[model samples]
Target: MLIMGEVHTGLLRNLGELSETECREVLRLTSGEEPRTWQRPLLYAISPDVLTGVDCRLPSSSGARIRGTGTVSHRATIVGGRVLQGSSYTTLLRSDSDQRLPWSHYLAAPGVVEVYGRPRWQDMADGFVTPEPPMDVLNVGAISGRLMGAVQDSARLDRKTPFKTTRTRLRWLFERDDARGDGRPAMRLTLGRDTMRTLRFTGEPTTDVVAFCEDLALHDWLLTTLQTLIQRALIGTAAPAQIAARLSPAIDHLLHLWMPGARVEEPFLPFWEELERHPGFTRQWTSSVARIRDQITVNTLSLLSVTESRREADGDPSPRRGVPQDRTQSHSHPVRRRIFFRADQRSRRRS
Candidate 1:
């Protein structure tokens, strides 16, 4: 759908915030909806902002005549006093513009998707170039002379907060004459005494906590790497083989460490041997996938071919059953059979 709107030409060149009334007009035209006082404009275009093409699809090879085959132009006009008083215009470009344009996609956020308004590689590159002058540069000689002063004020205010107050109390405890190493309390819950012998060796509480955190990070890394290797075996063989070949030795080292041990409950002896020995694993896995796919395609073709032949031979007007359909029924029935067979095997294992 295309939306068109006409605005006054006078306020085209001004740059600044627009008035509530002006915003309403733009919203009404583009979104085909009413604008509220609190609502912000999703797409803004003032009169002076010259829109070269309103079409969505235009061929570059078409040269000068290509004129926005699927482009829409929204020109922002800046006028006197920068009040942004001028009216705006909108053009609905053709849908084919999406096809002719080269577009790039990226994850803007978890669910929300943002598409670059332009569809050119150069535009994508140029999009990253910053145009605004730095705030410090704009302020000139009055640069952050009061930065330390503001920081001092913040520090004074923060010192009174309960969290900061706890640190202050802890600091006072450190200065006590009666303070002994064995009397120190736990940093976390107060339920248990965490006294340790004061040693001459240099040891800080912060350093101990940081070391503990680093060990935890290493454990997570090991788990993630192991899972990646396992999943890789199911995906592409060559990539997984290359990764496993490089990482298996390091994984072995981690498993040896008590602090960062492998999470696998069972020994994983067979799984490890399979990965370690199978250079042909990738070739075998890929070949299996190809064979399965080919069998499916060939079976489908043969079933259709057989069904047609049967219909011709019998001269039956009703639809003939294909071999593929029969095979599908046979496959579905095996699921129940397999489940019962596996349960029976488990019963034997228990016995």
Candidate 2:
């Protein structure tokens, strides 16, 4: 089986975390249908699955236009009442008939795209992941963005976010173990500007591809958001206090949302484990978070030290209060930057 999907993840446009009730209301996409909610690990909810019809050209790496027709599944989610994601995917199944099927037939099998005519499936897969697929191609991301906008632009949300982070899109492909001739697992992860692509071949017989995709998207969003936040923070140039202030939003809303593979099925865990070993998504996230916390700690200590020094300066019973305080006598370091500045600079160099 072949499946290609896209997920768009972003910080829910809210000043702070939304209540469980509010999250439910915000994700209510279907009329009178309540969104699915769970409490374990953290507050999580998913809107009922919706279907979107697409009769468009499939992507072709060789520039050969292949036609595909069918429906794409879309759903919205709220994680920890802070992060929001819109996911859309289609399972590509070979159609025995070359003729177009009735609309009712396509509707019956929601989220399945039946490929028409003879075209290399590999070419189609390659085209989909290409940096720039042809304009007139099946774009799962574009479809996903609309659903994302629907929830994100909802009136229920105040659209007031603590940090200025935008949505990150993940485009991925997954194939079953039996489909491959050799039957060995395979995986590839690619990161670009505000976008990521994952290719996976799993030997396990599991039907949790959508869940896995969303999970990957959620964690990748956390990773991408922090990576971008640190860049804009000007770590080396910004003082410890300033940097900490810049990263406070992440600490408040995102740090607690780092539960990886929490909701994924047991069979697909190895793919995530492989990624952790190589590119190391969680590893980088942990390092960045540790540095942010360290900055906060240093900022707190620096403030207290300065406060104590000022108390001593003022407590001096001598006539020093009357005279102008010497700059050398100040307790606060003139160079306010902390150890993070050098560490960040060296990391940048290595990168």
Candidate 3:
């Protein structure tokens, strides 16, 4: 069995981090279903799972025609009351019959897509992981995006964010363990262009897998957003003041969000450790943050120096210069006195 999903991560549309109650209100995606909230490791809230009906072709790398019809499960979530995510997934299953079943049958088995014909698992996985799939293929990502859009458009949000950054998409596939208890889990993560990521893992599926993916997506977004901020700063090319201005948002909105695996289950920590070992996500983040702080310090000193120079040029009293002069001291001349007397005498004569 295969469970495929996608998560869309971005900054919440609010000036500052939201309160717990506000997060709940914002994430209430359905009418009767209440969103769940947790505050232990972090302030996290997720809406009730909703299903989207999908009837489309399942792409196969071997050019086999396979049709799948089912409902995709998805939900919206808020992390730290600052980051928003839309997560969606559907399990792939082989159908007992070749024809499409009634809507009731699909509704009964939520988040499970039944394939009409036999399809190679590897071929389907390859096709889905590909950068671009055919238009006719099943698209769980589109469902996730729509859910995110709905939440973003809600009246509960102020629609004002501290920074402007692109949202990241993470498409993941989880294949159930075939050996059951004997084999160890394995994971492979890949980065794609335009802030897209793909992860393929083979493991014993657990209830916390969705939450694990959400955590990964959130951190990935933080990394991507901070990198973009630094690049826009143009460090050596732009003025220190400009660079500092560009990096301020990252410092204010993103620096404290580097908690990798903070909300994931214990079993998933090894996967995060694996990522850190190779790409060293946290190491790069630390370096980027240090550079931002250093630049800000340099810019502060530069501004102070410029202010001091201006004061000196204007003859204002500097600590290095002599004592300040009193502006109240007056200089009187005979020509000024004569003109004042003449003006008074002329006014009196006219009256």
Candidate 4:
């Protein structure tokens, strides 16, 4: 049977944001500090049976992935009136199922680490969202293995068969090294950067990164909208209450392009409901927004080439969608309750 549970920390998510070398460093440190029973250098022993390691390739957008196989250890702590909890998943495999069973365990207590240089916690939020298993990681491995398969099977996507499976393990140790004096935990679980070797992609330039970013423009626009709303709220010029009120309808209309479920009939249910329901929104929001910005910079440098290519293909020159309406155009806004209240006034519209 498959077992899974939610943890509040975002360590894994933040780790995903790091580069491939950084990820390997995490694996190295984790493995070196706590060697697994398994012989592989990539695997770390969280406990006698639990192991943790990197399970996927670095997304062209960001890098953060942690895969564990074995029994997990989990723990909780109370600090400054707030609860800080961290868990180590023991990824274990069974003969009956291909899925790895996550042991819902926690460290006995929280650990502590010194904050080095300027600290950024943006990616940490993705961690709290709690991912829906490591499907992307598994996909990356499968995609690679399929192309390099010794015996290709047309019906099988996971090229690594049961008999040819490359078993990798990973583990983490969250130990309380100090119990007194400093308010921080003696051993806190946070990402530590270390040196690692880079693994090259299988093919060179099969697809240009610029085109990929263009495809994700809609998703980027949503993040930009939310970020603007957040900035306004932070400045106190925009009411948090009002901004929250408009969040759902805004998210719905924004996400409708990529996700049909985002187009809900109801706009005002609790303001935070959309954010709460679609936790992945935040993850994609951060990564996609950064990716679009990066690609725009790259495209700008290669603008001449992109322009010439576009000219050759005769691509649409229309503005790439997503621009906020003026206050004068409030009548066209979806969150305007008066329009919804008046069916006759509603404009026939398509996002």
Candidate 5:
């Protein structure tokens, strides 16, 4: 069996994060099926499943002109009421008949694409992660992008974003671990400029393929976005205040949203564990987050040092160096406990 899918992840172009009610109002894609909303580990909402039909040339590693017809399932999701993602995928198999089938026949099995000839599973899987896909091939990314556009163009959003960012594409392929045949799994991931490719070999019956891949895509995107933010901030090279200004939006929007494998199935736990053991997704995230916080702390200390220097130069009235501040300013500007928010404690240092 061969399965292929694509996901597009980005920050929703909205002025403020949507509330639970607002998320539901935006994700109501189908009439009868209510969008699933949850808040246990994270606050998120998933739109009802939507299907799209395709009768076109299937992608093949050997450049073979293989025709396929079936429906591709697509859906939209909102994470923490802030980020938006569109996912689309279709499984492939050989059909009973070699001849082309009617549209009704394909519609019967949603998200299953059948080839006219022998199902070239390897060719299809390889072609999907190819660097240069053909012009006349199955473009799952386009199908996902349209759904993303639909939500981005909705009236609920203000079409304004906190910071400039573009969506990323993650194309993934999965197949049975035939060579090993030992009920083990392995995965390979490649990162490109604004694009990614993931290929997996699994022996277990992975029931929640789409959901698990979507979770992986989400975490990958988080890592990618944080890398960009840090590079743009230029923390060590730039002025402390300047770096702090560049990283403010990250603290407000991105830092608190790094939950890996939050929605993965039990069968895929080994894959996640292996990934952590090597590339260390959580380790990279932890290091980057610590860098941002350290820069913010330096900025805070710089502000305080400058304030005290000015006070001593002006001979400001005060009890002593070790004395506590007056009660008026003490309660006004509270100290930042976690530094997740801006440090507005300059008032505490003022005369």
Candidate 6:
């Protein structure tokens, strides 16, 4: 069986992280289907799966016309009550009959798409990962996006995010691992344009694969967001103050969100470990955080120096640090009153 899916990841549309209870309410996608919650490594919640019906053309690498009809399973998830993700997937299989079946037949087998004609697995996978496909091709990503949008538009959210960032889409395909007898999974991740990603896995498909991909998508978003923050800082080109202001959002909202396998199951640990070994996700993240701190320190010292110089230039008494002065006790200068009287007399003469 060929499993295909997409995940959309983004910051929650709230000013601060939500509590566990609030997360449950926000993820309530449908009535009577309560969202599942977990609080071990982090506060996590997932909505019950929903189905989206699709009857469209299946993209093919060789441009073969193949029609598919079925429903896609979708769900919304919140990690750490901060990041929101919408995930959707369906299994592609060959139909026994060439003609389109009734809606009831597809509804009975949820998350399964039946292709009318025989199609090569590689060709279908290639078409999904391709940047542009035919207009009539099934779009699982769009289904996931709509689900995410519904959560963001919920009244439970205040729509006041601390930082402005874009959502990322990750498309994945999983097939049986024919080579390995040990049951270890092999995977490939590709970065694509416009904040899109593709993953191909050769392993036995399990129920946990969707959760693992969601976890992967969350971390990828954190990495991508922090990288964009640093790039916007423009360290040497922009002033220390400007750089600090540009990077402050990461410090306030994103730095603490670097946990890699926090919510992932045991079987997926190796995939996270392998990614760390190659690109060193944590290593790059640590370096970026340190750079932000260093720049903030410099910016702080510069601001203090400028303030001291201004006070000296004005010849004003240095205000006692951390001392709160009462407005009623403020002293009025006698010379300032005399100057005001003289100014008032000049205004009268001019009139």
Ten residues in sequence with the least summed lDDT for candidate 1? 165-174
Candidate 2 per-residue lDDT over residues 161-216, each given as its tens digit: 88788788888887666566654447767777546555555455445888888998
lDDT of 4: 0.26
lDDT measured at residue 344 in model 5 versus the true structure, 0 to 100: 36
* Span of 10 residues, lowest total lDDT, candidate 4: 195-204
| Candidate 3 vs. true structure, TM-score | 0.84
Q: Each model's TM-score? A: 0.16, 0.86, 0.84, 0.19, 0.88, 0.82
The numbered model that scores best in lDDT is 6
- State the weakest 10-residue window (summed lDDT) of model 3: 323-332
Better of 1 and 3 by TM-score: 3
Task: State each model's CA lDDT, in order.
Answer: 0.27, 0.79, 0.81, 0.26, 0.79, 0.82
> How good is model 1 by TM-score?
0.16
Taking the tens digit of each residue's C-alpha lDDT, what string does model 4 give over 35-126? 12221221111212122233232111233443323322232211111111122222122223234333332122111111222222222122
Q: What's the lDDT of the predicted structure labeled candidate 3?
A: 0.81
Off by over 4 Å in 1: 1-206, 235-247, 250-253, 258-351
Please give the lDDT score at residue 16 for candidate 3: 85
lDDT of 1 by residue, 155-253 (tens): 212222111100000000011112225544312111112211110111232212212222222333333333343444343333222333333432333
Can you list the residue pairs that collide in candidate 3? none
Question: Per-residue lDDT tens digits of candidate 6, residues 276-330?
Answer: 9978888888898999999987665554444443444589666536533332113
**In model 6, which runs have C-alpha deviations exceeding 4 angstroms?**
179-185, 303-351
For every candidate in turn, the CA RMSD to the true structure comes to 31.0, 6.7, 12.0, 22.6, 5.8, 9.1
Number of colliding residue pairs in each model: 29, 0, 0, 27, 0, 0
